[model samples]
Target: MSSQQQEKYEESELYRIRHSAAHIMAQAVMEMFEPGEAQIAIGPPIEDGFYYDFDLPRPLTPEDLVAIEKRMRQIIAGQHKFEKKAVSAEEAKAMFADQPYKIELIEGLETGGVDEYGEPLDEKPEISFYSHDAFTDLCRGPHVEHTGKINPSAIKLLHIAGAYWRGDEKRPMLQRIYGTAWKNKDELEAHLGRLEEAKKRDHRRLGKELDLFSVSPDVGSGLILWHPKGALVRHLAEEFCKDEHLANGYDFVYSPHIGRGQLWEKSGHLKWYQENMYSPLDIEGNEYYLKPMNCPFHIEIFKSRVRSYRDLPMRFAEWGTVYRYERSGVLHGLMRVRGFTQDDAHLFCREDQMPEEIDRVLDFCLHLLRGFGMNEFKAYLSTRDPQKSAGDTQRWDDATEALRAALDRVGLDYEVDEGGAAFYGPKIDLKMIDALGREWQLSTIQFDFNLPERFELIYIGEDGERRQPYMIHRALLGSMERFMGVLIEHYGGAFPLWLAPVQAIVIPIADRHIPYAEEVAARMEAAGLRVEVDARGDRMNAKIRDAQNQKIPFMLVVGDHEVENNVVAPRLRSEERLDALRVEDLIGRMQKDIEDRM
Candidate 1:
């Protein structure tokens, strides 16, 4: 969300409704336990809905959720007026002394250092409590006038997940109940429908259904084992992008998986990024750590030799795999993995060529994503975080303005995320909006003046002086694993014709038609199509159904009539049957679609 939209959302009536709904839900849940059994933690209103954390007496279930939801509606119907009260530390402590979690939060509030969520506070806050009926919580008030203000029909209790207190894994585990609330039942239904569709399109479920990928526990969490079909789809996507890169003046480079500790220290990774990096490996009496980025190695290559103004603009690209340490709790299918390959590239250009290079890269990013039929996306310009950033004020400002200028020149609408940049520089992040309107961060064009200076990279200028070239780090597809995850969900496993693992499947009507099917498949394959021939003795309808389930683009049905006419009846996965056509004509039409990336 942009700053203006976020401000509007936070101040909107629906925001208050969700906030009050969370407190009401908390009241309903607190009633589930005895006087001092259930401990209440913090509850916050998030995008789309609200969630409340609780240290419950027992593990919750679906039945428990249903019961809690029922009680919530009752609480809402009670029409109790919400109230707030400011109290002293002693008074607050005495009110909920039995609740250990609330007491801890109260202590944080009393200290005037950290907020309720344990984040550092810029100034001391006036501690307050919000109460509706018998339950009250230590909170800053911005709730509805009364419980009756919330629509009962618009409210729902989603599900439960385990969350550590204050996001600290070592802290006590709490049950987080997620729920959504809208202005009306119609909106609620619409949201639920989208959620149902999302469930069906979930990458993990579809990945297994389509035999695309898997996360084997034996292979460790967050590690993807790409099956043949998934690997082929990735290969086709990468090959297409690689060809484009080569055509756009990018040269591929190879880098090792680990680097010396001193190299990382010099690059400032040891100081700013060591938390995400794995422990160093002891090799040849030197410390070598798994590379979490390919920038340093690419810089080393730049420093390998001297270059004049003629060689001022150099672009190095790589399908480099890097490793980072991710907690087991956050290890998602392919979306959030510990190890993945980045479609990484770095550009070293002199000051005079920087603006043109940025524009070209931005145009190329759009072209590449549009090839995958992803045209609905928003760009984000992340400025430097003062506390975390490494460069001087003037350098950071100039780099940020350059990226902003590029976005404006392209006429792409973008959001500026203040203090969200990487430690070393500013960046423009391209987030692709999927079919369901969820944004997936895919491409990034980062501007770094820090790395070139850190590595002491100098190129001879026209004035015969050693000058630091502007460096840009770019990744268009971010990572193969995550991009595949997004692509699988975006298309719902029915990829476009160009990127489909099996573009066409030839289904034989009977055992006698097997020879014709093989012949047709051979002809299509010879024309640069990924075709499969199903010669099983199964029924024709069964084969067609299987082909559709596999999400193939074309299902070529051949029998006596097609064999005699020397043609094929192409049935689309959409169930639309095209008229029978000669093998050459069918191949021509398919080739056109593939070329168009339809």
Candidate 2:
């Protein structure tokens, strides 16, 4: 979610309605168990809806959710006023003596440093309770005035999922009830429709159906194994982006997978990003670590020799694969993988050329994404945090302004996220909005002064004076794995003609037509199309249906009529058909589609 949208949601009336609904849900779930039999963990309103955690006597079933939801409606109809009460930690504990979870939360509040979620707080807060419908919960709430404020008809219980207490694995696993609450049934239906579409376009599901990629426990989690077709699509994407980078004055470079521990220490990754790094390897009695990023390696190349001012704006680009440890719980298909290749680049320019370099990089980022048919973007400018930043404050401020000015020059919609930058520098993050109106972070251009100082990078000017060079870091597509995942969902597995893994599939009408289908496929292959012949002996309609499911851009049907005319009848994935054409004419038409990137 965008920052503006988040702020709006937090203050909206719907947020309050959902908040109260969560409490109602908790009350209903607790009522399911006998007195003191069930334990309530936490219930909170989240984006789009709310969820509540519980340690029930037995695992919850769909039937139980239905019963709880039905009872919640009755409670809401009772119109119970939500009343709040403040109490001392001792009194709060005494009141919920049997509720061990609430007692633990009260102790945290009493300790004076953290909230109920175990996140740090600036100061101790007063313990409060909100009661309604004959049940009370420890909370700091902005709930609706009465239970009637919530439209029970607009609420739904989504599903049950297991969650660890306070996100700690060692803690007891609680059953979390996910649900959504809207103001009315119309809005609820629309949200549910979007969710249904999202499920259909889910990359993980599409990955299996399309035979694109897979993740196996035997191969380890968060590691993607790209099948032949998936690899071809990825290669075409990288090939196109690489050519663009070269045309834009970027020099491609390669770096090793592991580096000495001192390299990461100097880059501040060891100091700041150590948790994401794996345990070091001992090579020749020296500690070495997997490269979590390509920045340090690129910087080493910059310092390989003394550069001149004439070489001020040197752009180094790489399709470097890096690995970072991601927990098993968060390991998602392609989207949240541990091993991935980044479209990483670094720019070394003099101070005088920094602003222009920033502008060029932003323009280039858009150009690359647009090449993939992604046009909508939301830009976020993240400024440095005072407590965690390196380099001079003035330099940081100047770099931040440069980023802001670039965004302004481009007239792109953006938001300011204060004190959200990396410890090294201020950066501009570009998130591409997909077809479903979901934003995916794909491109970024960051200004870094810390790396140069840490690495002591310098260049000689015309005046024969050695001066430090300004460094700009960027990742156009972020990572190939995540980018492909977003692309798959954005297009819903029906890729554009140019990027389609199987551009065209040939379906023969009968066994006798198989020979001609192979001949037609060979002719199309000679014309530079990714073509394949389907001679599985299935009926013509089944072949067409299967081809459509595979998202093949074009399906060529060959039979006596087509072969006698020395042409192959072409059918598009959209079920649009065109007159049979000669092989040369077909090639021309398909070439036109590829040229337009349709």
List TM-score per model, in order.
Answer: 0.87, 0.86
Give a tens-digit lDDT track for model 2, residues 44-138: 89888999999988999999999989999999999999999999999999999999999999888898467878977888998999999789999
Give the runs in model 1 whose Cα sits over 4 Å from its true position: 1-17, 36-41, 55-63, 77-131, 136-154, 164-174, 182-190, 279-287, 433-440
Model 2 off-target regions past 4 Å?
Answer: 1-17, 33-44, 53-64, 77-131, 136-154, 160-175, 183-190, 432-440
Candidate 2 TM-score versus the reference: 0.86
Highest TM-score model number: 1
lDDT agreement with native, every candidate: 0.90, 0.91
**Clash numbers, per candidate:** 0, 0
Please, what are the lDDT tens digits per residue for candidate 1 over residues 290-402?
99999999999999999887996899999999999897877777888999999999999987788788889999998988888777778899998889877578768877887
